[model samples]
Target: MTFKLTPKQEAQVSLISSDATHIMAYGGSRSGKTFGFVRAVLIRALAHKSRHAMLRYRFNHIKASIVLDTLPKVMELCFPGVADNCKLDKTDWYYSLPNGSEIWFGGLDDKERTEKILGQEYATLYLNECSQIPYASRNMAITRLAQKTPLRLKAYYDCNPPGMAHWTYRLFVERRDPDRRTPVANPGNFAAIMMNPKDNEANLDPKYLEELQSMSESMRRRFWLGQFADVTDTALWTLELLDQQRIVDGELPDMVRIVVAVDPSGVSGEEDKRSDEVGIVVCGLGNDGRGYILEDLSGRMSPADWGKAVVSAFDRHEADCVVAEENFGGAMVQEIIRSASADSSRKVGGQVPYRPVRASRGKIARAEPIAALFDQQKVSLVGLFPEMEDQLCAMTTAGYVGSRSPDRADAMIWGLASLFPAMTKQNAGPNGARSPVVNLGYKSMKRKRA
Candidate 1:
C-alpha cells in the first residue's frame, strides 16, 4: 500500500486519477512509465476488487523485454512477498494473484492469435509500446474491453513518439480536441494523455541525467529528449514530399495511365520457403494530377508464379505496362514470366517486355522519395496492407527484421516508374537510372535502437 512513486510516474498516476475513460502515459525510455502503471493496476484492482487485468506488448519482443525483465519487478514492488506464489507461466504469460484478480501478459505480434485473446472481458488493460500494434488492431482491442459487471473498466496506453500515421494515434493524440466542454463521442470512449520525459524529473536519477548528457546527439534525442527525429540532417526526402490529395473511396477518376511494378523472387511453393520475395505494386495517376499507390501483392514465389501474380494485377487494374529490375534475375526473369503467362493465354507483350533497372544506391536512397510522398499525403494506400506498412514504418538504417517486409516499397517504385515512365526517363542509362541524392532523416519517434 506504500510503494514509492517516481516523480514522472506520480504525474502520470495523478492524471489517470481523473474521470477520463482512457489515459495515455507516453514518453522517454527508463522513465518508469510501465512500472508506474503496474502499481496503478494493483491499486485499482485492490480498490474495486476487479476480476481481471491485462498487460500487453508487441508480440515478438514480449518475452525478453517486458515479461522477463520488467514484469517481475512490477509484481515484487506491488505484491511484495507474494512474488514466490505468483507463477510465471511461459505458455500463458500471466500471473495470478490471491485476490482473484489476475494479470495477463501478451503481445500483438501475431494478429490472429492476439485477436483470440481480445475476446476476453477485462477490467483494466495496460499496453506497452502501443505504437507497435497496427492502428486497426489497436482499435479492435480497445473496443473489445467491455464488461457487463460495471467493474469500473479502464484502459492504460503508454508509448513513445512519433506514433504511426495510423488512426489510433490520430484519434487519440494528433487530432485537436473537439470543444473541451463537449465530450467527443468516439468508438473506444477512452481518455488519452501525453507527457515529456522532463515532466518526470523526480523519477530520473542524477546519474542517468549525467549519462544522458554524455551520450551522442542521436542517443540524447532518442532517450532523454524524447523527440521524433532523424539521425542525419541531409535526407534524400524530407517530410515536404507528401502531396495532400484526398482519396475518395469508390470514386473512379479519369486521367493518366496506371502502371505495375514488380520485384519478383526466385522460389515457389505453398510454404514460405522462398529465398526472396516478389513484390508487385500497382500505382496510378489521378486526373487531379496526384500520385496514388493502389495495391500491394507481395510474397514468396518462383519467376513463373510471380508472373501470374503480375498478370493478375495487370488485369485487375488494367495497367498500361509493367516495369521490373533486371539486376537479380536478368532477362531470364522476363522469359520465365512470359512462359508462365503463356500458359494462361495471356502474353506479357511478346516475351515479357521488362524494363531493365539496376540498384546503384542503398535501400534508403530508393525509399526516401517514396516516404516523402507518404508524408506529403500525396500517396494514399487504397487498401490496408499491414505487412508492407509494418516494414516501411519499422525500417531503420541499421536494419529491420521483426516488423514487415520492404516488398511493398520495391513494388511502389516499380509501379510509379512504370505508370509515369517519363518521371525516371531523363536519368535512364544503359546501366541503370541515376537516382537523386536522398537525405536520410532520422526517426520522428522515440524507438529503442537495438
Candidate 2:
C-alpha cells in the first residue's frame, strides 16, 4: 500500500527509525505529530514481534483519542486491511496484532490498571500527550523500558508544548535547569523535534490556518509557532504568590463562615451547543481573619448535573450559604440549585441558604480585589487545585488569555467577595464624597490607570 506522509511526519518517522533511545515530537495542534508517531510505533511493532505500550494521563482519554480515533486512522493509512485481523481486547485495552507483536494501552490514573499494564516488559513505549503526565509518573514508566528485544529499546513522547517550567521542556527542549534557565552540564540521550500547523498545511483546511493565526498571543505562540512563550508577566497571579499561600491539607483554622460559589454557564439548557464549565468553588473565612480556598468542584455539565454538584459541595462543606452569580441566568440558577437540593437523595432538613449576586462590573474588575487579597497574604489555599490554579495563573488585567472561560477564577472571586465585601465593593465617603484610596500595595491594583 502506497501512502503519502507530510514532511514533518516523515521527519518523525525517520527519528523513530533512528538509533535514538529517547525521542520526542512536540508541537502545535493538528500537526500530524501524533499520527506520524503512531504509524511509526505500529511499523516497529509489526516488524519486530515484541510487546509495546502506549500511555496517557487518563485511561478514558487514551481510549477516546487514540484507541477510537487515531489508531484506526493510522492502521487504515499505513497498513490497509491489517485492522481486520487486529484483535482488540476491550477489557485489557490492547491490540493483538496479526503478527506476534501486541500493543497495550493504559492510563496512569488507575493504579491497578497501570500496574497490570507495566507488569510485562516491552520493546518500545509511547507516551501520548505526555505533557499532561507528571514528571514523577513519566520517570516511573522510564524504569520499565528495559525490555529484552533485538529491536532498539526506545521511548516515543509527543505533546503540544506546555509552559517552560514543565519537565518536558527542561528534559528535552532546554536540557537545562528550569529555574535558572541554563543548559545542563550533562544532558541525556533525548531529542525533541518541533512542528507547527504550517508544517502540515497540505493536510489541514485553509480556514483552520486562519483560525490559528487569530488566536490570543500566548496561545498563538504555543500552538502556531510551537514555542514555549511565558505569559506570566501579563497574568495577575503568579506561581510564587500561590505557593507562598498554600497550606498543608487539613491545616485550616476554624471557619466563621463557609460559602459555596457558583458561576453558571450561559448555555445551561442548550445540550447541543458548547458551553462553559459550571464553576463551583468552596471557600471559608476563618476566625483568624484569613480566607481559605477549600475545594474546586468545577466541571462541564448540564444544568441538572452542575446544580447537584453545587448543592453537594454546600452540604459536604457545611457551608453557610450558596452564593451564585445571577448575571447569566438571573433567578434561574438559584432555582436550579434549590431544585437539585430538594430532589437529592441525601435529604437535609430545609432548603440551603441561597444568595444571588449580580455581576455589574467586568470579570477582571471583580477579580482584581480578590487577587489583591492573595497578595496581602490574607488568602491561602487549603490544598492544591491544579486546574483552578492554571486558570488563576492565566488571568490578566486585559482579561483571561486562556482559550476557555475563566470560570474557576470567577467562582473564587464570588466566594471571596461574599466573605470580604471590601474586596468587591467600591469604597466611598458616607455622604457620597470621592472614593478613598485604599492602598493595599497589590501590584495589580497599583498598575491600574487613574
For every model shown, the clashing-pair count is 23, 0
Q: Give the range where candidate 2 is weakest over 10 consecutive residues by summed lDDT.
A: 441-450
Report every candidate's CA lDDT. Answer: 0.58, 0.79
The candidate that achieves the highest lDDT relative to the unseen native structure: 2
Model 1 lDDT tens row, 218-250: 345545766543322333322112112223233
Candidate 1 Cα errors over 4 Å, as ranges: 1-3, 48-57, 163-169, 174-183, 186-222, 227-365, 368-450
TM-score of each: 0.49, 0.60
RMSD of each: 16.3, 13.2
**Total colliding residue pairs, candidate 1:** 23
